[model samples]
Target: VGSAAVVFQAARLESVPDRVSTLPEVEIQLFRDAVVQVQEEMKEIKERMADVLPAEERALFDAYVMMLESETLIDATIQRIRDGNWAPGALRHTIEENARVFEQMEDPYLRERASDIRDLGERILARLQSSEQRRTGWPQRTILVGEEISATQLAEVPREALAGVVSATGTGSSHVAILARAMGIPTVMGVTDLPVERMEGREVIVDGYQGRIYLQPSERVREEYLRLYEEEQALSASLREHAAEPAVTPDGHAVPVLVNGGLIADLKPSYVEGADGVGLYRTEIPFMIRDRFPAEEEQYQLYRQVLEAFAPRPVTLRTLDVGGDKPLPYFRFEEDNPFLGWRGIRITLDHPEIFLTQIRAMLRASEGLDNLHILLPMVSSLNEVEESCRLIEQAWQELCDEGRRLVYPQVGVMIEVPAAVYLVPALARRVDFLSVGTNDLVQYLLAVDRNNAHVADLYDSFHPAVLQALAQIADGAHHAGKPVSICGELAAVPEAAILLLGLGFDSLSVSVAALPRLKQVIRGFPLERSRALASEVMQSESSAEIRDRLRQALIEQGLGGLIRAGLH
Candidate 1:
């Protein structure tokens, strides 16, 4: 190893401290140089990847490079001066401006530019202030840093090169969390006061799965980590062995397993996993992935190709579910609570033209396919559902009237909000089917932010209230003779799947990685027992009671025993 380097591990320092040199001029110069370097790097990368990526993706790469080099310093500084002092978020706004530009771009590939731009800016900022600079020490190198890191930066760092990750501040979705999960590297975030500088070049063990970091770990700790790593490896090998098997319940009930895809790249994993179909094909992704709105022909071709790729298998295309938490900068939704604001069916009602265009593309794409379905997200009122159905009919009628070939996909609505659930019986009277978005449903029910770690634990899908609401929606849909499905993270967990099956959900959509395990859970599950458990759970008063009772019931049914053994 080279000379020891002091690593600062702590949270992000937004404001310069009194002890640290507040050299504004130096910071600006360094930023400018960094911008230039990023531009050069982007050009080189584009030159290498141009042939591999589509034309639209190529433009996204170019725009990201431009965003970095595009004098954001001047704009941000101007904002700071206007506000009388620099705010912690001023730089973010300047970056957000570029994000807006990318969001408005009409190309699917370019729309992803915003994610790239935001990630790049965050990385640059982290490098400027973060204690961990790029890899510098020799083989078996020792590097130092301060508090937690963003998930994006961790993802960029070489997994094999780094010994561990320590962060001062990070939530689950932060760059650190995402990167750590992808790399399977040991990491600990939210360690408010860990002394990173003291441990430079020293040995330590990072238990990422447990969210623990050990400095100067003793022999015992090291031994445990080695053993744990071996165990994890063995478990992973086991998971891989039966990845392609169909998920079937021990009682002989088979639930179709599918994948949720946002971008074209997500399709590769879905294909490899042998997903029965694309349960939720987010239409906004293509729109958000590009720099501008895709031309009609382009959208048609892409949708056609995706349909062709998964021919005969059902692919439910959700209309642009933007606004609220997932606001598009270019769309300009000025609401204090974007999540509660106009989105999904609301967006379609307000901008029928945008809705018509997408519907037309989907219709054209499904010309020879019969497995396509149209889904509406965040439907709060019966009118929204009716209007959406009318628009679909109108689009199909226009195409047929104009002698244009079109496919009429079955229409569906997402029962996410409480209002949707309450009115689901009425709403189901019009729509052909219903898919419960449990993530939002739980949040909307509990009035909590699922993404906010402080309240994350409170965001329980199994809360009796949430389960009751879901059961009500499922019952209402069934009463109205419509199929009810669950397409959310909750459906991915074995525990939650038991409840969903008991609640009378006809379909449960989950991620590709969780399918095999979920299948295993299903195969061992007894529907009669699950239904009985569900009835007992529904009658329970508190979430704790529900959780404990459900867990105990699983244990009694042999499923909980498997869970205790970590077979799930």
Candidate 2:
């Protein structure tokens, strides 16, 4: 639903042509200093990659570092300069000649290496050009339309001026999407047949959420987009104002509103945005972004940081939930139906050492505090939970054997798979808590992969079956004297948040951006009214009907502002 009006500008990413046209008297020291600066920049880039990109993919940056630090390249450039050639010209000529030689190689691998070298040379040239006081004059509020964007250019986007990004190619998991999300910029990737070349300087509307852009939109469309953007900004400001307020219902019920995915860099902001605690600190990110499985000490430091960041505020860490759509490069295996394939606790159960290392780290990270809770993802069988708990027991004993004092954290299961709903009653007994992952549950129950554009429409979390399962899981956990929470993409929707609160979930975890609006929506209703809304929704059979009824119900309950604000 997020949309913006933006001006399109192709990045100034051209490499130095073989025939050098402009001649500037640049000092040799400037060349030397720029190389060192780029080396440090590349090193910083690698360190930053640890937080986001997996270590394997970070070879791109490592290559740039090697190219900059290469004695062969550096010595050749210096020798050419000593022969009295212009520094920039000499450097470009030397790099380009090498790239030419590499490009002529019979090996495809060597040819690809040639392309990488040319790219690195272009980047170094761009930096040197900037150092020479040549500036890129970017227009205001750029959509940054491009066929492709490098990770380096992606990182250096003037975030303050970025309206959004439109790429002709890239998927949701692409680095472009990752960086754009981190910068909170709206971005549309994988757009095909977009006549961007002809549409330059035309007022365009980019809908990142919908992956569509309108060139020279009609007045009606222009007004609509402007309204949407205004409401979004106003709503964000309004939400931030109430960031410190408790999420209490009108009837004085306290429903803890937690934050999902407190990756190391995002913790402080989540807290500032009024997250009560971390309901789901996804641990898969560490595994997903690294080339190799992070060692015990590395995992221990991250878990400890999370605990310390929100001390006294509980953090629930979900074990590695990979193997489905998130196949590790290290663990390559074929699967006909990956969503139902080896994933979550299933993968960990088969690989005991992987499971043990993580469990032991979480246990040790808990050290003196009891705030850390471990959640088992995609649990379908009671054995997954039991075996994981047994490992937890053994981990605690090993810690004791080492003479380190530690408090054991609570173990919980995420009811995501369809089989998990029926097993909740059994799962409740063996676990300390339950969390309903509506995103996966809805997809699995409906047999619809939401990522599939053709079937995305059918993947409704508002399905009657989804509502019923949510209620069952919550009640099952409550009946067993354990608290339950809803930590999924669905919880971030304001209407869905209200409906979930009505479903008797003790807590709801959503993105930090949705906190203020969601809290505002939840506080608008009395617990009794939400229950009535949930009950009415549960009575309906059609997903569309349920959605309509909920919207009407929210409006009747005097929370229609969210409707106008485009909370959907």
Candidate 3:
């Protein structure tokens, strides 16, 4: 929770009139100089961001560099400008045309990349105008408000002066939200109804924990929130005190709490503390950041960094789980229902060259560490698993032939598809473990696109059907003498973590921001109590009932603060 004066950022480029204009030789030279200046500025930002942001985030600036260095963009803009077109207008048109292609795409991640293009265009436009275009009059405590907050905009603010952030359109997974979480700043996103024009200079409270904002709250409400804010601070301090503590139940049931990370920032002392190991090390980030496929050596180095950082602690590296929301720019495909098609294992299996290269790199990275665990995403049938195993074996044998001593890593399948849930026993027989990707499982099971705001309300991890699937997955994995774990958004919630523990998940892999709170819940709540709660939750007829049961359980345990205020 945080309160500050709202500063609504205006869309300056949009306000500028668009027109084609004849440019003199000097004007053309000015535009050329502007391009060079923007390129230098982008390089400086990229260098500065390398130290402050995670490797994955710093890669975002690479797109800007690519745009600035692109012969197509520069040549086209210069031609248009020399042909009696405004430089800013030409650049804006080119950017919009490119962005429109992505904007028309179904994937939210690609759609969000459109914003990055627009942001870069704005930066170049400001440079062309010979203006810094930097906002300077920030309040001591400023809550940056905007229709859509950009990573560059957030980075421009003085971290000390910035208190919170509110965007009218964005999800929790958006780039701005990721940066906010990294900076420990409170942020509320996807506030579609926020009156951005009226928010400026207003005193607002941002309840980021609950994804809420209170504009000009009453005295009583203000006082109550102030109290909540203090409690939240205390909770954070208390969580830190137990950072190194194990997430074992009071009744002696141990639950390993791991983090789901893919960036270099996850290797930081702050993020690594109190975690068991990486539950889901997304291998897609490195691939997504580059213009071309990463070389086997590049992949090996990146994977090795994560392996070495968490040496001896099992790091489950999921092989390229791209498609759906994440699409590689260099490699593109079209699908009617991309989520249900050409994604995850399907994509890799079709392109054995890609699969083999990645597997070899992973094997090489784990040559000595032996903590690497390979996970297959979106496995539906037994044949898929068999084929994947065959490929893995091929990579291992090839590496061994090269005289490199290697230990075969344990393999697992992500139970995201509904078919995988029923095939758990067969899968367990082949793989070493099972992991429930609750986010996608819920999406596929309920036939609701969680990214679609119109139908997002129907997506609930606590639904009776979802809970039943979790139970079945756990039971099937256990029957085959294999462990099952959840590495999704559901695993991060304290109340949900209790349910997962009760439902027989062996471990909970969550984001770094959620690790401490989950550890606290696991350490405080007894396993027996969690199991009992799970039993009661299974009997619930609806998601609402299940949520209420979870919330009441936390309140009864004197851990109500862990519950979001919106739930209350």
Candidate 4:
């Protein structure tokens, strides 16, 4: 394979400039004809791919085709213009403005979609102007560099056959990275702007563990990589031995290890790791992927599959936390700061039908399951909790009236909001459990935007304010005789795990990949020692000071390496 590493400072937008700057009468007529042609071609293509691709992939392709339908865009634009949503000459301007905002967003998914909008806008103008069509070709043996790839083109490459992916964008937690891991493909995205196309037909190597991409490696480099790969394989194989064992401390205290997952497909790894349960089930995925809300039957089918996949293992199914940063294209909403906008439980509450429908589906699907728990996200007030419970009750009554046997899952409220933390004593009394959503809790408490890379360092879970909130919530839950869990990324941190155990968390849920290291952390320190360390940590003035103190304590206890590797 050919490989090169020339940094792309900025993407060179290629299109026929001024092609649609002035639209004529003849051009508008041609645009309408083009729309008809594109629609016909799309219909024929879908029919041909019916048997070749899976239903999900087929649906994705259809959605892509729908996006390119000139009639749909024209109609949508016309409707908006008629409704006076945009002033005269603002349609293209609106799309361009939003596109730039998306480009600047930290999330790779949004950033890539921003570029997609730009492409879409041009196509709309082309349809309006009757511009000459451009031919598209394949980039075989070429490592395509972009922030993200089209969802329709996601499965184009055979998993093992593909060399590697080096995206100009993508976070470790993004869907693209998750898919790459599942496919067992070596991927190192977020590589600034490496010239991916030049790597075509060039011999190269990808080291995902070290996030490195070697271009035209010499014999020595190849040999070293082979040796390291073998070593890694051996190390991974060794982990299977402990897969069946309960994760316990040296003194024999059992710490339940669970996996965080969204799809039922993740259940295989959860079972293989001997996971106690699913810590977090992102229930918003199905809704976000679809063009519109799924039918009640369709929702039940998917939920039923997940309930059956884990069987007896507890699955904490969080309600749809859509809107804000994660807006569904099907639903239109405007907001200044999406992060602080209407989201999570608020969306569900406002749209009671949506909430009731999902609850009914989950309840019906969980007919024989005792481990299903419904978790509410972004809850801040007691009223929201009360209303959510009322909705659950209403759904239960409806299910009963219909003579459908259903098991109403336990309701848990995430204590992420500052107000929720303050009222945990009262909220704990109403809910079955309390799960501290530290990712948001820390972000909200410090008023720091987690997505802002420039201020990411300030977003620390170990902050004194964050710890104090955690302590309060956990203590309140304990007092109320309800279980408390930390489903946030902080629970995965080695040092943070010690504090969590000390602060009275019933369970510490983390990413599946972090389990082994967390297990090591558990074995290295006693519960009592961790409690003492926690007490000292809580008294520290600043998060930095607390981190330093924790490091010193870990080093004193001969766990510097573990802390450094997993925590820092």
Candidate 5:
């Protein structure tokens, strides 16, 4: 839950004009001038973002730049207007055509790009309208409401005045949501039922924690949220006081908390303030942002910066986890079931050259500071692990052959597939450690695609079977005398972190935003009590019961603030 807010700032675009017959020459010139003005404004925004935003976020503007620089866009617009079509209609057609291609894509990441196209198209269309048509002035404690809030739209709001954000489109993974989190603003996305047109200047309460919006809230409701808002502030301040403290239970069990990062921005003081280390550095992020594969030198520099930031603190880097939900724009492929198809180790192992280059860069980057830990993603068989190990060794040997001193990094396999759960004993015997990627593990175990909204409700990490699997994996890894850790969304939850602690996870790797609350939860809950709770939940037959039990546990401990509103 984040700070609750009153007053809505509706950010709607001007209505598009209807298509008309050939415009006068003056109208055409006006249209051209508007296009140039919007393009220049976009350029200025990009330049300003260079110093403030991360590389991945700055890349969000690349699509806008591409659209503005497209000769086809201008040429097509001019030709269409000359041939008896309206400028706004012509631009909308082009944007819709481009967006439709991505909208039809199965990958969630690529599909979200369609929103980017629409966002840019709206910006240009807004410029086409008269200045008087646009709304100005933001209210105090503004809850920015829109059909689809863009990164630039979010950027335009004053930080102090912006309390929350709500959108009718996009998911938590959208760029706007990502920026909101980075800025510590509460956000709710994909609110299909939100009455965007009527939300202007309305007194609304945004329950970001629960993804609920209150339209002209009752006085009782407003008072109660006001209480929550004050309590949240006090709790946040208290949590920050202990940010640098170790996550040790009152019963004396110490659990190291690490941050899962992908971008260079993850190295910011805010993110790393309380982080023990970088638990899972998504190497695919660098690859995903680029048009082509990043060279070895480029990879080396990036990895080295992360290594140097938390030197001596272990940083586990997952090697190229692409081809499924995350596909490279440059390296395209078609699959009936991409998630179940050749992804993760399958792709890297198939192309040893890509795998080897990455490994070599990782090894070389860890030259003096030996804090690098290599993690292999989506491993189901013994052969994949063995082959991957061979490639790592080959890379090490090649680097050493060049007379460069390096440390042979510890290797681990991500137990994401059901096959890997049963094979944990064999897998643990081979690798230095095991990391449970609960996100994919739960998806594969429950036979539910977490990304698909239709079945998303059924994707429960607390399912009885999933809990049992976690217990089994932990037992198997411990039996083999190997350390195990969890680095997934499950690890980020305070309740789940408590269960993971009981399940024998050596460390909990969560997002930077989740670190403080997780630490507070860990420090408040006793290890023995957590173990008993885990055992009790494992025996429970339903996920609802498990959640109730967990929620009750939080309330009993006076950590009820961590619970989402309405759950209490």
Candidate 6:
């Protein structure tokens, strides 16, 4: 279902050289007009960001606005244009001068700001280029293919026009990837060694889930894909028929199926009714889309809306999980291994103010509501949990002191690191609940980087050791009388969901796209059969053996379509 084939253009930014030449008054006026136009657009962009982005992130555009209004930068551009240079060239020269000066700075943060300056410069240059020659035509059913699609470039792509996107290099953590997902566009990144320049505007099939791009298809292949797509549509229709129904099995086991993402509407029109509530409210959405950390009030408004939308139903909000793959423009760090570096609770702990701001906003959002739940991401130590607890208390107290109505919402830790899995028994006792982020947990447990396409085959969630760890974590949490749910992508796989159910996970959270299939699988097998399957899977020695066993069992149980349909 996560696949689409379309005739698309190999879109690439055409580099324009701002030349050193004389410009007349008319040209200078045009440059002024471009600047004013861009400034007006930036204002609209900022307002749009406020609704979707956190305050600090919305502040990103502030710098761009300031740069546009900066008398120094603006004067330099004007002087260069008046001194006989193309307006675009004059702007670029000023951008390069500022970049050069910033690059020479001694302070690391100041040096990093050079990147922002460069980014703004590019935006301005792009505007200048567009003023010269505006694009009025986009081919039908286009898929944007490029080495990388910047945030600025992505915004220019008409949302209603682009069918999908294929990138030669990008990770799931990249901002482009996040934007693509938010736009509901099918995208496959890290596609290597394709002659895209020559194949611009060619028919291709993009399988996002499989990470395959079929360049040119014969009639046979095209027909096959068409058949698969139609089959997918029919199956999706059948699954959505029971959207409002609870995830209950033949034996009357009702397991709450929750959807994970930043927005509640992300699940609407299909699986929203089926979903219980937010399992992993990735708080980083605002951060990822913006240039800086969100402000306290800006963060609060966003949090309050989400809480109000799903009031009374539990909504787990994951605090800032930044660093590494998800880097902020304002906060830059050098890490040998970023995933293990200053991230998640580490970032919050290190920056207490940032942590407190988020906590205060979260608590205040719960003003008269009890559905707000705070989850600390990438927590691996008791000290981190204790420190977070202290901050949470301090923030809650501070808000109460301010005469703000608030509640001490439930606090939880995400079990993504192996250390967390081992510490679950202790962590469960400290936190109200636990969630296994299998995407990171599997890689951490297996010592594999799923981002490395070369060894992606090694990133198996079905590994016996991984399965054992899940079982242990689930058991420990339940033993401590704390509920545990899985919010990782793995939890959405029908086969994996079946195994998780068998593994004793109290609940499971997945994307809306996978909700129906997951529910179907849950309803297909009774609790006893799932538990039995889980027991057998845990006993298996290897992933291959486990897969074979599960396939046979699913077929024998008349649920083979779950595997054949690729939901497994």
**Best candidate according to TM-score:** 6
- The alpha-carbon root-mean-square deviation between model 2 and the true structure, to one decimal in Å, is 10.2
Task: Please state the error at residue 537 of candidate 3 in Å.
Answer: 1.6
* Candidate numbers, best lDDT first, in rank order: 3, 5, 6, 2, 4, 1
TM-score of each: 0.68, 0.70, 0.73, 0.69, 0.73, 0.75
Q: What tens-digit string does per-residue lDDT give for candidate 2 at 37-133?
A: 7788888989988989988889888888878888767778766666665455567667777888988989998888887776666656656665753
User: By summed lDDT, which 10 consecutive residues of candidate 4 come out lowest?
Assistant: 9-18
Candidate order by decreasing TM-score: 6, 3, 5, 2, 4, 1
Residue-by-residue lDDT tens digits, candidate 4, 216-294:
8889988887776665556445554565677776666787777666655566653535677877887877786678998
Kindly report which residue pairs in candidate 4 clash with one another.
1-201, 1-202, 1-203, 2-199, 2-201, 2-202, 3-199
Backbone clashes in model 6, listed as residue pairs:
21-84, 21-85, 22-84, 56-293, 56-294, 56-295
Model 5: per-residue Cα lDDT at residue 295: 97
Please give the range of 10 consecutive residues that has the lowest summed lDDT in model 5: 1-10
lDDT string, candidate 3, 423-511, tens digits: 99999999999999887888899998754545646778888999999999999999999999998778877889999999899998987
Question: What shift in Å separates residue 28 of candidate 2 from its native position after superposition?
Answer: 24
Q: How many steric clashes between backbone atoms does each model show? A: 40, 1, 0, 7, 0, 6
Best by lDDT: 3
| Alpha carbon deviation, residue 512, candidate 4 (Å) | 3.0
Instruction: Show where candidate 3 strays beyond 4 Å.
Output: 1-187, 194-205, 214-227, 565-568
TM-score of 1: 0.68
Better of 3 and 4 by lDDT: 3
